[model samples]
Target: MNHINEALKHAEEEKKTRSMMSSGKLRSTLEEIKTEGNKAFSSQKLDEAIESFTKGIEVYKDNQEVVKLEKCTDLTKIAISLFTNRALCYSKQRRDANVIADTTYVIENLSRKNVKAYYR
Candidate 1:
């Protein structure tokens, strides 16, 4: 019984340790990606910006820390920025399909305030 209990505790501790490590790594990568995306956007590299933002989003998509309701606000902001950049790029290239798709995604995911502010 003692050995069994010890084994269980060790297993649980290992599980928690792994979870914590992954959480921290996910957060760090997300921040890095966001910063890179912003830099790319400022440099007029729209496609690269989109790639960075999308990769960051994918990393956080299933994280419990990222899934919290409070984090949605920031997530929405990222989504809006990415989609807006993509839309603008499409507009410049005269790609109506991409522009509509990106615009629709931003409107659906972002807050009404953001939608109104961006459109205006």
Candidate 2:
């Protein structure tokens, strides 16, 4: 029973990934979210900025299952940006743990040479 349930879950995940890949809206959506987050950050709305960045990160992570199936360097780059920007917001809020988690993700998964991430 567990095996069958696991197979069904995998099939469902694959179906969602294929649908998201076919839509082709992920890039534009992520860009919009990033822009909104930047605007919020510029306005010194740390909480709002964090919300936007977190939303962007969640969107990217949701579709990440298809990343291996289809190479999209742009998406990865945007995801990295989202994490970095969110880390900045966390820093401003004095949320050291959140900042560390986001920056660590960037350093480990995206760019080991990201000096800012290392510094954060």
Candidate 3:
């Protein structure tokens, strides 16, 4: 019974640690994903770029990361950029509805004044 309690406590601690995300690490991960997406975009690999950007968006949406940030505005701005870039990819693919949806997401969630979102 004593050993089981200790194991349970250790598992809980591990779960807590895994759920704690630092803002710096979160930013770094987002940037790395964005860079990969950018590379794909530059190579004219629209689909791959969209996939990478979508992954970046998912990372940005992680609750742990959002809770860790002191000011979530930075993340929101980054999300706007990512969505706008994805909209560009959709445009290249002639996926007009997707482009509109992505841009609208940025406009609604990030900022109405975002130039890229407006342009999209």
Among these predicted structures, which one has the highest lDDT? Answer: 2
Q: Residue-wise lDDT of candidate 1 within 2-111, one digit each (tens)?
A: 99999999999777555642544555666677788879878888778767867765665545444353454555565556556556655656877877776775566555
- Tell me the TM-score of model 3: 0.79
Residues 22-102 of candidate 3: C-alpha lDDT, one tens digit per residue: 777777888888899999999999889999999988877764345444776766766777899999999988999999999
RMSD of each: 6.2, 2.9, 4.5
Candidate with the larger TM-score of 1 and 3? 3
Model 3 global lDDT (CA atoms, 0 to 1): 0.83
List TM-score per model, in order.
0.54, 0.83, 0.79
Which is superior by TM-score, 1 or 2? 2
Runs with alpha carbons beyond 4 Å of true place in candidate 2: 1-14, 18-23
- Predicted candidate 2 versus true structure: per-residue lDDT over 1-120, tens digit per residue: 999999999999778856664325888889999999999999999999999999999988888865555778788888888999999999989999999999989988888988778877
Greater-TM-score candidate between 2 and 3: 2
Judged by TM-score, which candidate is best?
2
Task: Please count the clashing residue pairs in each candidate, in the order shown.
Answer: 0, 0, 0
Report residue 74 deviation for candidate 1 (angstroms): 2.4
* Deviation (Å) of 39 in candidate 1: 2.3
Query: How good is model 1 by TM-score?
Result: 0.54
